[model samples]
Target: MEDALRRQQTERLVDHLERMGPGRVWRPVVDRDGTVLAEGGGPLPDNLEEYISGVDFAGKSVVDLGSNLGFYSFLAARRGARRVLGLDIDADAVLGARMLAALHGMGGVDFEVCDFLKTPPSIKADMVLAIDFIGRAVVAKGRLDQVLATVARLARREIVLTMRAVYPLEGLPPLEPGLRERYAKHISDGKFHAARYAAHALGHAWKGRTIHEGRVDGYVLKSVLVFSSNVAETWEEQGGSS
Candidate 1:
């Protein structure tokens, strides 16, 4: 009986680790039940709480792109969103998010493993979060216009976007000379052109607020942009979801 029990316990632990991880979670600052946790190791997550200080999520629905561990998805649900859907490409991360939501009893929150580039979600929402996703895709895929259009379509009310503010490896490790030169051109082009390309895509439709931390000479920091449709403009005029 003892030997059988040990095997069962080991099987259960193996299953759990297969779903969660040793250090793979993007945001583990919250407990399994959504409570905040203080941690050591890496830097704290940049959820952009201050950006949302004035905008209320009550009764709105949110779709989060690249919702690694559902951190922002949980935030939306807790802030009174009627529903929140977190989409990621990683199957294990989506499974982890779903399992954690079950533990937290967060029926308003859901997660799916999806490749938005191929098959975009048919379900649109009041808000779309493309944080740390759009600029990278634009830079890497060279499909700036198409990607931005999809983002606009996903959002019925508002869009919250964030991008890395710096990209210059003037003093980094030695990459192969050709690879390094190509990467340097890519970085230089992306840094100069992504923002302008974004404006051409859909920035003209909505007025926005820009949020940036001052430049760090050698580090990348998060920069945010929040914009709304004509209907969502009420969020600014009324200080909450319209």
Candidate 2:
């Protein structure tokens, strides 16, 4: 009986891990009741622990923009976030998030139908998440800067931004100047967002100007811009910007 019980327990444990790590490139994480919590497009580029630790999501209140299926939002809740507000432009995504939250009996997380770019200036948050959802084009006429400034304003503590940059590295061929300009517009839009945040006192007073944090490995020459929400003198004391 003991041996059989041990085998059963092992099977159960294996089942749990399998459920937790579905191993799909981009799969919707559903609760026991089949409510979608999160979605990603490809196999996880990194492990859960490494991703969470790298992003530093512990105990923070997160604002997830373009939350798609709620993958990161659910992870935030599991990793000790006090509250997570998942916002997406799509009604379907919002419904999926709410269902997923219910499935897990997760109370501190909620979803809304709002554009991250249009989030009002009055709200301040610990973290703002805008992962690769800078959809469509970034440049056109005069609107590029306006778009970026909106992003900057939404972030009170830090902005976890993941958008393609304007320039390409050696391995990558040069995209047309127009394309580069478009990408550049996106970055500038984010900066514009920062400027608005600064202007409205939603974040630190405009500190000098924005700085590039260098390219993430996969992003190549395209840099990961780190815009701060604190005065320059206090940045180091405040744990640096992302």
Candidate 3:
């Protein structure tokens, strides 16, 4: 009887995936029995374990911005994060993440559809993950300073920000006229060095520290910037003028 029920449940899950299409990111998401459910095509070239191996999320409140399929959020919950919130602008992604969470019995991790550029969540977190978010914002011509300020405000201890970059410099490279016009179509944003610069700027603005930085190999050349809290102060003091 139990075997029959398990088979039925697995069939339902697989049916859902067939109806929804492939995951936007976090490819080859599998079940405990190693059943491949969704094949992803995003830029996450590494596994979740490799991406989150060094971080200490135990007993922390974690927020994952631009969390396509709740990959990092579920990993944080598994790693003992007290509370995990995953937010993305895609409604379908959010819905799929919720379904996956329910199937896996991960009630602690919550998924929401939100545009972090316009309005970030009200809750502050011990750690915030903003991976692969900057180039899209650049294509949209979003204010990079305001975006950084919002991340700084919501992160109580640390922030892990990653973006695609051409050079390891503090500013972006110039684009040709043709390339600029192509980027305006929302296909790509050329290359961006603003994430590293913005991370450092936020560290100075909030009196934090640039704790770590390195490259993350993927479909594109990516860089990771980590900012750690160095001082204790009221929200008003830490929230610099926008």
Candidate 4:
């Protein structure tokens, strides 16, 4: 009963914040391990939790690429990361992350506004998070391989990458017609590189499955692709040059 009430309260708070603007509000949820942070959006999948928890950020530093609204970054700080830099190409996201840190009184967290994949190579972190980032940016730009290589170089210890996987390197979906017309010249001309890179990167042997789907203004679905830092041979070559 108490748990239900708490969730109801949190949902009410989320409603209030939604009315106000595009920021995040969260509440704590209690379980066997004590209180775990639960955002207004409700529970995330356990796979995501496992991925985030694998990064041993306790008393360490982290770089969050494509840190949308900063859900994971906040969780990392709560888990004892010494410093967390939330980087995003969107200025509003960066500001929102800063506001969230201040609102929660977590001073060690910071936000950076930059195209992180294009930022100076000197910036490094113990762990780098590229969750749901490559498909939106690199694949859209037909540069998936470059981005994956970059993710590896940016992290000293590990790179956490998640995106959709394409098999056969030929049967993948093309960019939607409207998006292709607005962003590029053609749709079915091999302009988007999701398939080729997946073939080269994973050799069609990596496991994959659907992860999330919902109606967000329009119905959309996304798959999760996880590539570990240990698999980035290109990044290893780049490291030798520096």
Question: Top lDDT: which candidate number?
Answer: 3
Measure candidate 1: CA RMSD.
7.9
- Compared with the true structure, the alpha-carbon lDDT of candidate 2 equals 0.52
Model 3 Cα lDDT, one tens digit per residue, 1-242: 96676666666767766766764544556665666667765434245556546678899999998887787788888889999999998887787777777767786899999998788778899999876566643523545556677788899988776654333222444443354443332223443334434644475644432222343344332445556766555222443211
* Candidate 1: residue pairs that collide: none
| Poorest 10 consecutive residues by lDDT, candidate 3 | 233-242
lDDT of 2 by residue, 1-242 (tens): 95675455444433433454443213435435343333443423233333334455678888877776577777778788888988877766576567656645677899988865555445666877665444224332333345456656666666655433331233234434564444443244233232222223323443322233433333332123334455454333333342
**Candidate 1, lDDT over the whole model:** 0.61
State the weakest 10-residue window (summed lDDT) of model 4.
Answer: 207-216
List, in order, the clash count of every candidate structure.
0, 14, 0, 1
Stretches of candidate 4 off by over 4 Å are 1-51, 167-242
lDDT for each residue of candidate 4 in 1-242, tens digit (9 for 90 to 100): 96676565545434444554534332222222344333434344343454444455688688887776576787778788888888877765566556555545677888888775566346888777666565554554555656666666676665555554432224444544354444332223443434234434533223222223222223232333333434544422322111
| Cα misplacement distance, residue 142 of candidate 3 (Å) | 3.6
Off by over 4 Å in 2: 1-27, 30-40, 44-49, 118-122, 139-147, 166-227, 230-242
lDDT of 3 at 167: 32
lDDT of 1 by residue, 79-173 (tens): 89999999999887787677666655688898999988677889889988876565443545444445567778898887877654444344323
Whole-model alpha-carbon lDDT for candidate 4: 0.53
Winner on lDDT between 1 and 3 is: 3
Identify the runs in model 3 with alpha carbons over 4 angstroms from their true place.
1-9, 23-26, 42-46, 136-140, 165-192, 205-221, 231-242
lDDT of each: 0.61, 0.52, 0.64, 0.53
